[model samples]
Target: MNLKDEKILSAWEEKQSITGVHKITGYNWQQIAKVLSTYGIVANDTHEIILNLYDRGKNAKEISKITGYAETTVHAYLPRVRPAYNENISENAKRIKKYRQNK
Candidate 1:
């Protein structure tokens, strides 16, 4: 997907609520959710908050602060989450590198 679509997905993931995402993106939440389905992302599962936060760019320390989970516990859960935390981090790094190159 292009940057705009990525941003929309990012916003959706960050908000973690259909209405919240819809309000910001001005797109129907269902449509946004459909896009998420295509990406294998299932939004708004409370049990997945840690994983979701990780996907939205929160590190173990950050997630720990937000979720009251210990940093080590967050680290433990990272591997169980889809895409793996390290892989997600690498992908983010690549995105940032490409973005910088474009700039």
Candidate 2:
């Protein structure tokens, strides 16, 4: 690998997000991932990457774009990691009722 590629790989190995690596190296996430794969370096799982991005304050859509997962999938898995907020039992019931009705 060239010196520049080596630096980018080092940054990726340091656990920098694909976005961070892109910013520093000018290589998009897909290209970086492909290169990593060629070196037999496996990337993180979708759920783990999504949760990390979410914890860093990225919304579901942004996380989806970054991680290449469907937004619906991200939404489905997020509630498992982050607690759902309900102002009251009534509000929770109302939401459930609405959801059931929609279904």
Candidate 3:
């Protein structure tokens, strides 16, 4: 972790709100959320998109097509998928896993 992050954690331990931390660090809530998740922080925005797609039962490739992000990128964040969400499968999705996976 960088010095800024260390300081942010210290501030957080002192009960600083995320908005406050963002103000001090100039980092978005998502970036800060990722850091917190690394330490087992459950409330972060981690898996937000993954869960959104997963609930809809969209595969990594389908999510990639819809999101324009690499399938691997979507797959990589699977671990963070929300524990509770819809689990319906996506239909008529174009498979683009190869292009993204090879990268």
The predictions' CA RMSDs to the true structure, in order, are: 12.7, 16.5, 14.1
Clashing pairs in 3: 55-86
The runs of at least 3 residues in candidate 1 whose Cα sits more than 4 Å from the true structure, single-residue gaps closed, are 44-103
Compose the digit string of candidate 2's lDDT tens values, residues 1-103.
Answer: 5565586688887765666777878876656655554454545576467667877999989988887888876664453332224423577799898999999
Candidate 3 local lDDT, 26-62, one digit each (tens): 7776555555444444333435665577568898789
Quote the lDDT for 76 in model 2.
46
- Cα deviation at 22, candidate 2, in Å, is 0.9
Backbone clashes in model 1: 0
Going through the candidates in order, what is the number of backbone clashes in each?
Answer: 0, 0, 1
Clashing pairs in 2: none
Q: After superposition, how far is residue 78 of candidate 1 from its true place, in Å?
A: 26
Instruction: Determine the C-alpha RMSD for candidate 3 after optimal superposition of all C-alphas.
Output: 14.1
Q: Report the alpha-carbon TM-score of model 3 versus the true structure.
A: 0.38
Q: Can you give the TM-score per candidate against the true fold?
A: 0.38, 0.38, 0.38
Residue-level lDDT of model 1, residues 1-103, one tens digit each, is: 5454576688876887667777888877545655555466655553267678978998889999999867765664453335423443677798998999999
Candidate 2 RMSD computed on C-alpha atoms after optimal superposition onto the true structure: 16.5
Q: Quantify all predictions' global Cα lDDT against the true fold.
A: 0.66, 0.65, 0.58
